[model samples]
Target chain A: EAGVAQSPRYKIIEKRQSVAFWCNPISGHATLYWYQQILGQGPKLLIQFQNNGVVDDSQLPKDRFSAERLKGVDSTLKIQPAKLEDSAVYLCASSLGQRVFTDTQYFGPGTRLTVL
Target chain B: GQQVMQIPQYQHVQEGEDFTTYCNSSTTLSNIQWYKQRPGGHPVFLIQLVKSGEVKKQKRLTFQFGEAKKNSSLHITATQTTDVGTYFCAGADTNAGKSTFGDGTTLTVKP
Candidate 1:
């Protein structure tokens, strides 16, 4: 079985520039999530998707951030006009279902975004 | 929003020393999980505890769920350089199985 896969392990951009990251989850996984981890901080959930529908995104910064899993197998998170504070590791994870207590999660190497 | 916290945000241990990190939540949790992230890596699932006061061990790592179900702990025995990383504990409450991860405890081992 393959593990979660993400593109562009590292990215560098200036403030106000747009950036995007992509992820391909493990096969047969039904749930996907996007999180942002700042330096010295735990990951903060940005959005979650169940199949092709969103399960939770209340914490997402809608004004500047957007994500979509059109076919439910892959996902893309975009940030428009990025900020210096947005420089962090963008992590993507997937599980078989919402029952994380019973289902294990697999993570990718994450995209380290650096905003100048 | 739920409040989940972890203690000893940072710890330094010499080789062969034991260390532990604690997790606490304001609300009762249905289950708790542990994850470890090595330097410059993403979190990888370690284990989950559902039953109250449950204890599980993996090699030198031991995880315990509190009797109150709102707290948990992870103990590592005889630390090694390979044990260096940030450990995060997350709670999956009865509400929807959604989890809130606590700020991780970064462990540094002196070899």
Candidate 2:
């Protein structure tokens, strides 16, 4: 059983530039999530997907951030016109999509984005 | 909006000392999960508590869910250098799908 995998362990971009991050979740997992973890803060849920359909994205910045899980196995999160404030770690997590009692999320090594 | 708060953002102790971190939620939680993230590493699931006043132990680590189901605590006994990391508590709402995580408590052990 392989763990969740993410690409580009680290990234650096200038303000107003665009950046994208990719994630491949664990096999057979049905729930995928993207979270933003600012330094010294907890990871904030940006979006959640269940089988290629979005379950929740209320916290996502519609104006600048977007994410998609086209085939339900992999996901990509993009930020256009990135701002310096967007510098944070992007963490991708996957779960079995069970009830809260049994749903334990496994996280991937996050992509640390540094916007200058 | 729901909020989970953790106290004592940071703790430093000797290798033989014990340490504890507390998590409190603004609303009742149906279940709570704990994760540990070492420096420069991703969060790994530690444990989950569902029933009220449930207690579970793993080696030297102990987790407890409050009787009110709105608070939780993680206690580590005789901490070692390997115990250094940030511990986070996430509370799952009645909806069963949504969860909110606390800022986390970072523990540092000095040998």
Candidate 3:
């Protein structure tokens, strides 16, 4: 079986510019997540979706960041008026369900974003 | 908010030597999962521990969950070049599968 897939493996933009990242999770995986991983740091959860509904998004920066999982299988994360600090890798992961331990998130080769 | 601290931040090991990384969580975790990321690759799940004071081993890699469920450890015996990468320990937040990853420990193996 194929793993979670993400597009635009890399992205470069200037501060104040808008950028978006796309992800396609594994088939039948009902749980999807978006995370931001700065260089030399761990991935931080930005948002989570169960099927088409959002389960959590407390960490999201509503000011300039937004994400959506329209059909539930694929999702997109966007950043508008990007800041220098927003230069980081955007990662997408998927799991079988919301159960702790039973749900092992499978990550994709994140989209590395660099804002100048 | 939950936070996981990984020790050593970075480790350089000679091939055939042993390597170990520790992770501590600020809050009790229902479970802990480990992942490894190659220099330019994505994070791959290594293992998960759900029981308190649990120890699981896969070949030379041994993972341990603390009895208090707030700490964990990963030990790699006789490390090799293939073990080069960053090891991360993530705690499953109370929000279920939502995981908060630790600042990974980058391991460099000198051949």
lDDT of 3 at A70: 96
Q: For all the predictions, what are the DockQ values?
A: 0.74, 0.77, 0.74
Off by over 4 Å in 3: A98-101, B95-98
Query: Could you estimate the TM-score for every candidate?
Result: 0.97, 0.98, 0.96
How far is A89's C-alpha from truth in model 3 (Å)?
0.6
Model 1 residue pairs with clashes:
none
Q: Give me the candidate number with maximum DockQ.
A: 2
Q: Write the per-residue lDDT of candidate 3 for residues A58-92, one digit (tens) a residue.
A: 99999999999998789999999899999999999
DockQ of 2: 0.77
| Residue B106 in candidate 2, Cα distance off native in Å | 0.3
| Candidate 2 lDDT over residue span B42-109, tens digit each | 99999999999999999999999999999999999999999999999999887545699999999999
lDDT of 2 by residue, A17-90 (tens): 99999999999999999999999999999999998999899999999999999988999999999999999999
Ranking by TM-score: 2, 1, 3
Model 3: colliding residue pairs: none
DockQ of the two-chain complex in candidate 3: 0.74
Best by TM-score, which number?
2
Output the TM-score of candidate 1: 0.97
